[model samples]
Target: MQSSISLPRPIPRTALAQAVLLLLYGASAHAQTPPTAETMLTPVTIRSGAEQENAITPVTGFVAKRALSATKTDTPLLETPQAISVVTRDQMEAQGVQTLRQATAYTAGAVSNYFDSRVDSFSARGGTVTQYQDGLLRIYGTYNTSRPDPYTLERVEFLRGPTSVLYGQGSVGGVLNLTSKRPQADTLREVQVQVGNNARKQIAADLTGALDQEGQWLYRLVAVGRDSGSQLDHVDDDRLVLMPSLTWKPNAATSLTLQALHQKDKSGSLIGFFPWQGTQLPSQYGQIPRNTFISEPGWDAYDTTNNSWGYLFSHQFNSDWTVRQNLRRTVSEVDYRTIYTSFTANAATGRPARPVFNSDNRTVYRDASWQINGGRMLLVDTQIEGKLHTSSGTEHTVLAGLDVQRNQTSQSSWRSVTAAFDVYNPVYGNFRPPTASQLMRQPNVEQRQWGLYAQDQIKWERWTATLGLRHDSAQTDTEGRPAAAIDDKAWSKRAGVTYQMDGGWAPYVGYSESFQPLGGVDVYGTPYKPQRGQQWEAGVKWQPPGQGISAYAALYQLREKNRKTTDPSNPLNSLQLGEVKVNGFEAEMQASLASRWDMTLAYALTDAKISRSNAGDQGQSVASVPKHTASAWLSHRFASEGRGGWVVGAGLRYTGSQWSGTSAISTPSATLADAMAAYDAGDWRVAFNVINLTDKVHITQCLARGDCFYGQARTYTLTSTYRF
Candidate 1:
C-alpha cells in the first residue's frame, strides 16, 4: 500500500489560473429574472416536435409517463427503457441545484457527496444508489437514512437499473424518482427572492388555480425558505418548505390526486474539501463558510430537523382499466456536533493546527405502493393484434399488471459522546447545556425493513419488449428479538429492441436485472442472496420532442457479479465475494434554437471497477467513482428587443477524477465550473450564481472508519422573482 503521491514538475497551474479567475468571476454574474420560487419552472420546451410517448413501464415495466410532465421536456425523457436521467425543472434551474446534494450531481451516472458532516451518498452504474419518491424506496447511507430535500421536488427521475421488480431491496446502482408536484391547468403565480454570500437569505412560493367554475377542481400551493451563512467557516443553514396539491376530473373516465409536504431544516456539516495541504486558491477556505456550518464541534453546535407527510391515489377505469395508489408518512430528524482545526504540514513541525472530529444522527423512513392494470386482454399481444400477425405483420401490444410495494423502514440511532454513555464536555461555549451526567444512555438501536414486489410490460411494433418477473420478500428486524428475516425470492428480466426513426433515430438493444437486500444481520442468523445485476445497452434517440428540439445517445455495459462487500473485521459480517464492473458512455443535446435559443448538453464516460475483492483480485478503482462527467446549458432570448423585457440563462459544468476508497483511494477533482444569469421585466426577476467555476480542489467523503470528508470549495448565489 504505497504511493506517497509525487508530482510537482511545473505543477504551478495555480489551480488552473484560479479556475480561470473563478470562471471569470462566475462568468460575470449578470442578473434579472422572475424566478424566485414557485418551484421555479417555465423554461422547458427544449424539444417540440416528434410526439408519441409512453413508458412508465416499457423501459423496464412500470415507470411509464414522465418527462417531468412536459410543457415540453416534462415527463417523456425519450420514452424510457432503462438508463434514464432527468433532473429537470429546467435542469434544476440551470444548475442552481439546491439539495439532495445538489440534485445528485447532474446525473448521467450519479455520484453525490457529504459523507463527512454525517453522510449523504450516491453511486451509479457501479453500485450504491437509493432514494425513490414516486415509486417508493429510500435509503441514505453511512449508517443509513436522511437525504431527502430537493425541496419536495417535482422532477428527479434517474432509474438506471436493478430495481427488485418495482423496487423491493436496492443497489444495482440505480433508482431515484422523486416527481410529486402535480395539480395543474395553468393560471399560476410565483415568487422568489435571493441574497447571496452568507446572510444568503432566500424565499420561495407558488400558487396554482382552477378550483371550480366548472374546471373540475385543480389547485396547488408551495413555499420555501432558506437562511444561509456559510462559505465554510463554521457552517450555517436553515430551510423550510410547505407544499399542497389537488387535482380532480369529474368526467372522462375519472381522476383524482392529492399531495402534502412540510419540512424544516437547520443545516451545517456537508463541508469538507481539504487537500492542498495548507492554503491557496480563494486562499484555503471552508471553516464552515460556504454559508456557515460546523454544527456540534468545538463549542458544540448542530441543529437539524425534518418533518414529512404524504398521500396519493389515482384511478382510471376506462382506458382499458387502470389503478394506482400511494401512501407516505415520514418523520425525519438530525442533530450534529463537530469540532474543527486543520492546517497540518508537520514535516518536522513546519505548520500546525489539528483537532477535527464529529458526529450526530437521526432518521425515520416509511413506504407503501399499490397498482393494478389490464389492457385490451388476449395476453402477449394477441387480441387480433395486427389482425393475428404471421411472420410478416407486426402488432403485438400486450400489457398485464399487478404490483405491490410495501416499505416499513424504522431506524433510530445516536452516537455522540458515547464512552458507555453519560459523557459531557460542553460548558466552554455552552454546547447547549449538557451536564445531566454527561448524558449517557443506551437502547435506541433499532433497524427494521419489510417488502413485496411484482411487475410486467410489453409492446410490439418497432420491436418494443419487456419481460419482468418479481418476487422480493424481506424482513430485517433488529431490536424486536428476531434480529433478521429474509423471505428471499427473485426473477428479474428485460429484453429490448427499438428502431423507429427517420429524422429522429431510435436505436435500442437491452438486457436488465437487479435486487439486493439485508438491512442488517449476518452473524450467522443466515439469509442473504439477492445481488444480481446485469445490463448491456445500446442507444440512439434524437427527438423533436413534440417536434421542435431534442437529443440522446447512450452506450453501456454494467455488470455486477455476486457483489456484497462488508466483512471488514465484521461490520455486521456480510459477505458475497464482490465484483463490480461498469462500462459507460452517454451523450445528449437539447435545443430550442432559432426562436430564442434554449440549450442543454450532457456527457459521461464511466469505467468503474473493483473486479474482485474481499482479499482476492483487489483490482481497485471505485472510491468517489468517476472516469469523466460533463454538463452544459446555454440560453438566449432578446425577443422584441424591448417592451415587457427578457433575457436569462448560462451554464457549464464538469466532474472528473474520483475514487477515494473501495481500496483505490484515488482522490481526484478539479475540472469544475458553474455560472448563471437572469432577468425578465414585466413580472420582475433577477439572478446571479457562481460555484467552483474554478474553485477546484474537490472531494466527497465517506468514512465511518477513522473518518474523512471534503467538498464544496467555491460557491455563490443571488436570486429574485415575483409574478402574480
Candidate 2:
C-alpha cells in the first residue's frame, strides 16, 4: 500500500509526437504527388454497393448486415427491434481474438464470467454494459480506463435490452459498441507474428490505403506490440498499441475522419481473490494452485495509460438529408496494486470470518491495496438524418440527436494489513508498505451528461415501426467531497414493431427504457435516486436472401428499480428498496456455411433474480450470472489448388451453474475447448490457436464476500500473417 500517485508515462509522449507529425504529413503528400484522372478513378468508385454495407464497414465472413448500435441508424439487423450481436472483422480473425472478452466469446446475451486481465468484465442481459467507442462513451471512472485492442477492432456490437432510447444514462443491460478501424479506400497491408503459451510474444500491423489518388485522402495505421505471460504465476501481460486514422473525402457529399489512440498496459492482476476456502469450497490445504501467485510478486500491478483523439463528421444534405458528427477526447491513467484475502470479525455472525487455517494447513490473512486513478473524457455527438416519403406511402426513417458528456476524475488510495502468506507453504518478503498516514484522497470527480434524442423508422408494406425518444441531463461534482451536487433528470422510451415475413422471417417486438443516477447516501443522508429500467423484448429474425446466413431469437422481460438494498433496520444503512428481475432467452447463429463452412451458434437462458429486496436477498441468483450459456463455432476452408487454403476450427463453451453473491455457494458447471488451424499460401498466412483445450480447472466466480475467480487456462497461439 504505497503509492503517492505519480504515474503518467506509459507512452503517449504527446500522442507520439502528434503521430510523427501526422506521419510526416501523410508522407510528404504522397511523395509529392503526381497522379491524375480524377486521381485514377478514385479508388474504383469509393467503396461500392451501399458503401460496402454501412455501419463501420468490413465484413466478408461472420455475417453482419448493417448495425449501428441498434438504431443509431444504419439499421438492418433484420430490421432492428432490439437484440443485436455482431462480432465481425472476419470473426476476430477466425477466433484468435485477444480480449474484448475474446471478442464476445460467441455472444448471445453476452457475459464474461470474470477472469480480469485488467478489465473487460462484461455482462449484457443481466445488466452492466456500456462502453462505446466511435459511438461515443467509453467508461467514465472505476479502475480508470484503457482496454480496447482486439487489433483495434473493426466490429463488436451487442445492443440487447434497454438502451435508454438511444444511449443516454445506461445499463439496463446493453450497448457495447466498438467499431474502429477507419480510413480505407481499398488497399490494405498486414503483418502479424505471434507465439503462444504464456511466454507469448507478438507484433502486429495493419495499414490501410490511398492517401491521395483522389480516394479523397484516406489512411490508416494500426499497431500492436506485446509481451505476455499469464495463467497466473507472477502475472504479466503487456501491451502497447497505437492507432492512427485519417480520411477526408471532400466530394461525394463531404466526410471527415481523424482518429488516434495510444494505449499502454503492463499488466498484472489476472484477478485473484483466493479464499472461498481454497477456492470454491475445498480445504485441508488442497486446491488453490491453478498456477497460484496470489499477488505480491514485486507487489502486483495493473498499469494502464490511454490517450485518445477523435473526429468523424459527415454531411450530405441532398438525396434525403443527413448530418453527423462525433468527437472524442480521452485520457486515462491507472496504477493499481493488490494483495488478497483478509477477513476477521464474526462476533456471532456479524459476518466475515471463516478461513483461519494455519495449523500447517497453510497460513493466510493478508490485505493491501494502492490505487491511483485518473480520467478525463469529453465526447460529443450530433446527428440528423432523414429519408421521408409520406403521402400515405409511409417510409419514414428519421433520427435526431444531440449528445454530450464530460467526465474528470482523480483518486488516490492506500490500505494495509499485510504479511501472512504461505497458501500451502510459500513465503515472500515480510511485507509492509502503507504509509503517508495511509493516504486516501478522493474528491475531484466531475461528470456531466447531456442527451436529447428522437428516432423514427416507419415503413409500410412489410411493416416496420420503431420510435424512440430520450432526454437526459446529469451532473455530479465533488471537489473536496462532502458529496452533494448530484442532479439527474431522465426520460427514455422506445417502441418497436417489425413484420417482414415471406421466407426470411423478421417478427419483432420491443419496449425499452433505462435510467441510472444513484451515487451515494443512505444512513439518512438521502441522495440516491435514479435507477429505473424496463424492457420487454420479443424477437425473431432470419436472413435468407443471398444466404450468408443469420438467425436470431429472443424473449425477454427485464426490470430494475432504484436497487440498493441492505438497510434492513440499519445494518449500516443503504436502501432504495431494491428490485431487479430478468427473465430471458436468446439464440443466435451466424453462418457463411456451404461456401466453405464457417458457423457460429450461441444460446443463453438467464433468469436473473432479486425481485424487490429490503436486504433479505429476495429470491437471490444473479452474481456472475449463468443459468446456462452455450456457444459453438465451426470452421472449414480447405481449398488449396493454387491460391492456397486449408483452415480448421472447432469450439464450444458452456457455463451453467452460478450463484455466489447472494451466495449459498454454487459454482459448478464448466466446459471449454477451442481449436483452430490455418494455412493459406498466396499471401502467407499461418495459424494455430487453442483455448482452454483440456487444461480446464474452472471456477470463474465466487464471492459471498470472500474471493475466488479463475478460469482460462490452456491457451496457445502461433500466428503469422502477411498480405499486401
Candidate 3:
C-alpha cells in the first residue's frame, strides 16, 4: 500500500555500538568484585510464578495471590481495584485444559467455547477479547489468530474492563495475557505422556536448571508432539511445539532473558456450520449424526506454522529506580482449503438446497478453493519505574513507558461451484476441483501504532489510589486500495481507589476508558472514527486472616459507540451509527475448605443490548451473550500411605438462554458436567478427565436461520506425568 505516513527507522549504528561498549564496560568493571552472601543466593520463583523475590504471599488451589495484568506491576489482586482472574498452572492441570477456552471455562464473565475451535477467541462483558503475551500485544490480522500451546504457559491472566489506559488500542471487554515459563534457579525436570479418545496421543517434556556453577547462566527447554483425531469422520488434529529460553545475570541488580518458540499445526477446519433444520431442529431428511462430516474428505485441509522470539531485559540503576525493555518479532503462515455447505432451503424441504444446482437434492455443495494467509509483527517497549516519597511522608510508585508496533498480513484465495450429491450415502471422485485461473486476491494490509503512557500509584496508610493516562497514534493502509487508508489518534485515562480495612477486607471502585481504530471507510468514502468505550465498576474483596479463602463481588456497566453497521443504501459499504451497552455483575470464591477439600464458585449476569444502530438492530439483544452463567467445582483428596494418594473432582456449569442476531432464533439454556480422577504414587501421577460427562447435546450458539454450532461432545483423556 502507498502511504504518506513515515515509518520509524531502526536504531542508529552508533547508538547500537555505544550500547555494546557500555555492556562490556559494565561487565568488566564489576567482574572482579568480591562475592558476598547475596551473590550466593539463588533467584526465587515465588508462588505467584513471579521471578521477583518481593511478590505476593504464597498461593494454593485456584486462588492467585497477585496479578500482573491490572497494573503491569507486581501488585496484590485485592489491592489492584480492578476485576481480574488468574488461571494458575495448578488449576489448568487439574482440569486437563487442552485449549485456552477450557483453561478459562470456570471464570466469571468470560463467554467462550463457541466459534474458532482452532484458535482461542472469547468475549467478556459484551465485546471481543484480545490476547497478549507477557503484557505485549500480539498482532491479529483477523479474529482467527494462531493458537499458542497452552502447556508452554505458566499462567493466564484476565483483566476485565477497559484497559487502554495501559494498552494503547484494545477491546474494552478485557485482555488475556499468557505468561511463558522462564528459566528458574531451582533445578526442575518433568516428562508427560497422554492418551485420549479418538486415538489421540501426546508426549511432552520440560527441563530447567542452572547452566553453570556460578549460577550466572540458566536455561529452560520445553517440547511437545501430538497427534489426534476430531469428531469428524476424516478430519484430524496434529501439532509439534518447541520452546527454549535462557537467562543471564551479571549481578543481582541486572538480568536478561531471551525466549523463542516454534509451532506447527496440521488439522482440518473445525467449523461445522450446519443448516438449522437438521442441526438445531429435526428435518424431514432425518437427523445428521453429531460427528457427521458434510464436507468432502478429499478437499479439506489446514496447515499452519508460527515462529516467535523475544527478550526481556531489566536493570536496576539503584535501589529505588529500574529500567526495563521488551521486544519481539513473529511470523506466521497458513494454508486452508475446505468445501462446506453454505446454506439450505428456508422451507421444510426434504433435501439440501443450493443456487448452483438445478434442484434441491439430499446433497448440494460448493468447492471452496485453496486459501493462503501470511502475517508478520514487530513490537518493542521500554519503561522506567521508580519509588518516591511525597512531602507528607506518603509513598508513590511511578511508571513511564514508550511502545511501538508494526503488523501486516496478506491473503489470496481460489474457488468454483460444484454439483450435488446424496446426503444419505455420499459418493466422491465424481467432480474435479477448481483450477488456479479462478483465483482472487485480497489487498495486503498493514497497521502501525505508537504510544506513550504513564501511571502513578499513591499509598497513604490503608488507602491506595491509582491514576493512569496514555496517548496513541495509529495508521492503517491497504496495498492496492489507497482509498481505504486510515489515520487515528486517541487518549485514554483510568483512575481507581481502594481502601484496605482490618481483617483483610478491601473495598474498591474504578473508572476506565478505551479506544480502538476501525479499519474500513464509510459509504461516502470518509474514514470512520475509532470506537470509544468507557466503564464504571465497584467491588469488594475479602481474604480473612489465617483462612485459605479469597472472595470478590463486582458490579459494572460498559458502553461502546462508533460501531459500524451494514449500509442498506449501498449494501457494499457500512455506516458508523451503532452502539452497545452491557450491565453486569460477577462474583467468585476460591477456597481450601479443609485439609482434604478444595472448591471454587463463580456466577455472572450480563444484560447486553443494542442502544443504537442503522441496520434495524436497535433494542435487540446482542448475539451469543447469555444472560446468566454459573459454575462450581469441588475436589477431595484421600490421605496417602507413605508415597501414594488419590483425588476426585467434579464440576457443574450452567449457561442461560441467548438470542441470535435474528429475533426469532434463540439458543436454549443448558447445563453440563465434568469429572476428574487422579492417583499419585512416588514420583509419578496418573490422571483422567472427562468433560461433558453426561454426553449432553446442545447448541452453543445459533447466529442466523441456517447457522448453528453444536457444543463439544463428551470427551475423555488420560495423562501420566513423572517428575525427577
On lDDT, the candidate that comes out on top is: 2
User: Which residue runs does candidate 2 get wrong by more than 4 Å?
Assistant: 1-67, 72-115, 128-172, 184-210, 213-215, 222-233, 242-269, 276-292, 295-386, 392-395, 398-425, 428-456, 459-618, 624-702, 705-724
| lDDT at position 85, candidate 1 | 56
Q: Report the candidate with higher lDDT, 2 versus 3.
A: 2
lDDT (10s digit) by residue, model 2, range 6-29: 212232233234334443443344
What does candidate 2 score on TM? 0.32
Q: The CA-based lDDT of model 2 is what?
A: 0.79
Better candidate by lDDT, 1 or 3: 3
Give one digit per residue, the lDDT tens place, for model 3 in 565-653.
87878888887788999999999887765436678798999999999887888988888899999999998878632224898999999
Candidate 3 Cα outliers beyond 4 Å, as residue runs: 1-42, 46-60, 113-115, 143-145, 343-361, 421-424, 435-439, 566-573, 593-595, 640-644
User: Which prediction has the highest TM-score against the true structure?
Assistant: 3
Model 3 lDDT, full chain set: 0.78
Clashes of 2: 0
TM-score of each: 0.30, 0.32, 0.92
lDDT of 1: 0.51
Q: 88 in model 3: Cα distance from truth in Å?
A: 0.4
